[model samples]
Target: MYEHSSTHPADPTTPADHPAAPDGNALTRQSPFRRTVLRRVLPAVAAAGIGVAGFAGFAHGSEGGRAAAATALSRDTAPGSALTARAASVRQAAAADFPTWGTRWVVHASADVNSPAVGLINKSAAGQDRITADYQVDTGHQVCEGSACSTFMAHLTGPVTGFLTVVAVDIPQDRLPGVPVHGGGQPQPGGSRQEMLDRAATWLTADNGSQVPYSQAKVWKDGYRQDCSGYASMALGLPTPGTNTVGLATDRSITRPVSLGELKPGDLLIDAAGDNNNRHVVIFEKWNNDAHSSYTAYEQRGGHGTDHRTLTYGLPGGDAEFKPYRPVKFGD
Candidate 1:
């Protein structure tokens, strides 16, 4: 449900098909449920072969010490020193997958989309003693159609056992509600990223026809939603032509498809929801490479007039991260 505050105006960017709260945790696998089938039980049976593993000691002993006079360095040695250390700690926590690895199950949104882990959790293992990694479905943004559009493909390595398959869940177009398409013409305020994102979020909330109501914004001549994408579209003066069974892109200005490798800050990000086809949309803000993988973003959560927060996810939400999907190029 959407929350309200007087400080923010009505937003227009919320996608029409924004998803509801996710059903459950992503650890448990949907298939492989049958007790009698042979191939269905293969994975659970094979996992029994792993032995009880135990972690050993760390070698912190100084091998060859040459005593010398020492001067301790101060914490102020660098600007933002403390802040950097805190950031490092946050990253370290996100990276560790030990406690919840084996007990978790993989919950696929559809045959196409797989879950991106929201957080790590622990569960007792029935098949093997080893901890299994927990994974969950992604529920922010709009893509091709709806259902399964947000499906995922994950990469797994040793000590972090998870998924390593390549199939996409397909959200069909029919179930999705269309975006109320409108194009703001030239001469209005343009190029403000946050403003645009706010609008998109508002519009999306409105589309769901849910119980909550969103905030409103007043441009020169129109009453806008205070969500993210709505603001982007309003700034660009793109028309609210009508909703598509699939979600709408930020700019009608886009002609050529953009490759994921070339995404820019202001470009629009789309997502597919299970059963609904193209359920939501959000904008890309920035990218950081120092992390293990790329993250896509969205501005609000819980639908309707909700407070704004930054939400990041696996690169492009699917296998598209591996190849390329014609992304809308900036200044194009």
Candidate 2:
């Protein structure tokens, strides 16, 4: 299961507060200018050897060596092996592109283009190497270049059953987006409150503008568990596969307890004391009334995948286990 248990099961009925699901056709419709740009850019991306097959020899080796490597990559169909080979290829590409840079390059990946990058490859020796390698797979796409070349997007497949566009980028440790430029403060993960909400909104219509299904046992294409905590982690810019409900509640580096009256957009209401099947968390969006008796929140529940609805989980007459927590990423 996705580490969350909801009192409400997945239901077909849409709540009054739930935003209508997007129209699939309308979502796919692109402006002529966008289409023209894609046509011009895709060829360049392919020529740059950005795909899995291309990456096999993208950075190193002679023609024959490249062909052999590509063939070996093709033969190794296992997801874990493929991800390792791909990560190695990315590392090699980074090394070749920026040879003077040290081995301290950390690679962040996001399956969603709008979402913040999660730490896929850490600068420290103790990073998650092949974290979601065995999950699912999706084809690769070039999401950045030139001015925005800090990140590259690709795809993966697995148990979670969704296409993963692995957005991997080789960013220097000190140069990471949220890092303190003068090296005086702790590095914060990237994303403003609006950006975080925007990231959470992506999953609502992730599948061609449709809600990503819930899965406690699997992760969504974005590599987040399709559960309350996983969704919260994605919103907060935490590492992929996400921290558990307990971790979200207790980890000072990630979040700290706050009074209900202090709740703001992007804060969490977490019930972390119970087992996975009983634990849950929700993203507090805003109070429905100044009275603070009811508020709107984003949740990834058992039956309904991603939902934005009015909830009183932590209010006076609400579920007592739920507590307000301000994500530490927001800073004091």
Candidate 3:
């Protein structure tokens, strides 16, 4: 549903792990200095606009009943305008192709680190643009200052191995083992940010041995293999296809940007160097006594694996020079 966008300015001067924001509405600190929550609300509109249940054989049925020939999602189009409707159906199909929230997909890409799959998806969406001016390709979740489609896909590199599909917010019980379960099952109920965060914590089973595996599901038999954005994506249930450090915290539908001192326990630390390779993201564990003196975080690194490290402010190594953001639940 997205490429990449410059939602944040890149500041690669530092490369160190650091503490996270605290929990609750405004970042609460007991210090003498003033406290203020960075205030901004942006909702993540679905690029995954259509759902699978809506897909089917809707083409070639004549202008009377044909819907989308691509995915078969149901259409609301009235007859006598099938040509216009056919193009709209394709756009809907592209939207339906996305995975649900809290659900991850093992994307298969032909080029760059799993980026070809994204291009394929985007290309399909953009192809519909030939239908008319109203149609557009996979416009990423509204985080960029301009059109999400053109701006986000402008920068593309890497393979799809490390990718995790993020989708819209979902229920808490959906976080249970093998939830949003494939095939028919009783629909899982959703939860708030706390519930999703708690569920993500359960995946940190092999803290000592866990590595940031590209295909976490495949390699996860040994342990939960996760990358930084994958962990945050799961924790927030930001809807699939998922986003990278570049879009993680800034996705309008899921979170709002915040200053570092205003961070909460479930907030995120993102250092998006305007590029996915140079970018890194982490989840803030908590503030020690709300003093802002020291803190801990959960992250997936290259050699060390997924770790919960205690870090002080102003450390180096791509962890500093970052910004904090609050999940939607906390902000609402």
Candidate 4:
């Protein structure tokens, strides 16, 4: 499903997993700015007795005032309210109750991932919306936010694949600063976050068994000897091939420093020792929860080609010496 122009690589530091936030949002919920996770099995807010009129007013008034509450309450429980049928459609993209690999789906956005959204961002805004968000799944229809509504349906439609849960977050609402949002909520196989994971899983579980060893300065498309940084580069679609663990931390185009609180899937975390040949780096996958204790990662190190592993949070004593970073660009 993915077309990697280059190849996937690995990390140089730890031999474990990375970090990701799982802020759940399907079509609608309250608390817009909190860390979010778009879920396949969404919570029914109808029980809350929130009204849609309030959200419609919020959407219109906030655009003019630009002071939409950091914690906007959910629009009332109207099927016709903001989190409409389309949002529900996106919420059901999972093959099962949660997101996982192999679930199938589609993505529809207002505009392409490269475009800018001035207004009327998404009708597909599902789950609890956040300014900075990322989307993932096993397979199913997934709708992410963009400048415009990519789907012509004016309704729910992002046929999923491999996983469920469409991430349709609207960014830059009036005075809100433009934060990092996922590409038009759809399956962009050319080079998308989900595609990157799909490609990595291919190697991890090939029919003939392709995933092999971890090689420093190695870029073999053949048997795929992905090192730690190499695996990171390939999965993220970076221009560099043999970028080592040190290069990942130092290279600007590849990544920029960020806080551990803002960590997302595909982000990076270098150890306290800093970037270098011997020091290490790992691609953040996802955290267990808001506690930031345990997490998953993707990398190739310790002679392993490439793998999805788990690790604990914190410094040597498990307190977190994370020199966290985010990818500047994955693919166009």
Angstrom error of the Cα, residue 176, model 3: value is 16
* Residue 307 lDDT (model 2): 80
195 in model 2: Cα distance from truth in Å? 1.0
Write one digit per residue (lDDT tens) for candidate 1, span 65-97. 211111111000000101112122332322212
TM-scores of all models?
A: 0.30, 0.52, 0.39, 0.39
**Which model scores highest in lDDT?**
2
Shift of residue 102 alpha carbon in model 3, Å: 28
Tens digits of per-residue lDDT for model 2 on 1-332?
12123443221211111111211001122345432322222111122332333232121221122211111011111112112222333323211111111111112133332222232232123432222222222222232222222222222221122122222223322122221111110112644676566566666666555666676666654455666677777677565557777788888999999998899898998876645546667898889987888888888776567787888776777668789999887775
lDDT of 4 by residue, 21-105 (tens): 2110232322334212222222222212212222211121122122221112111111111121223344444311211111112
Alpha carbon lDDT of residue 207, candidate 3? 28
Q: How many clashing pairs does model 1 include?
A: 97
Q: Model 3 scores what on Cα lDDT? A: 0.34
Q: What shift in Å separates residue 272 of candidate 4 from its native position after superposition?
A: 8.1
Number of the top TM-score candidate: 2
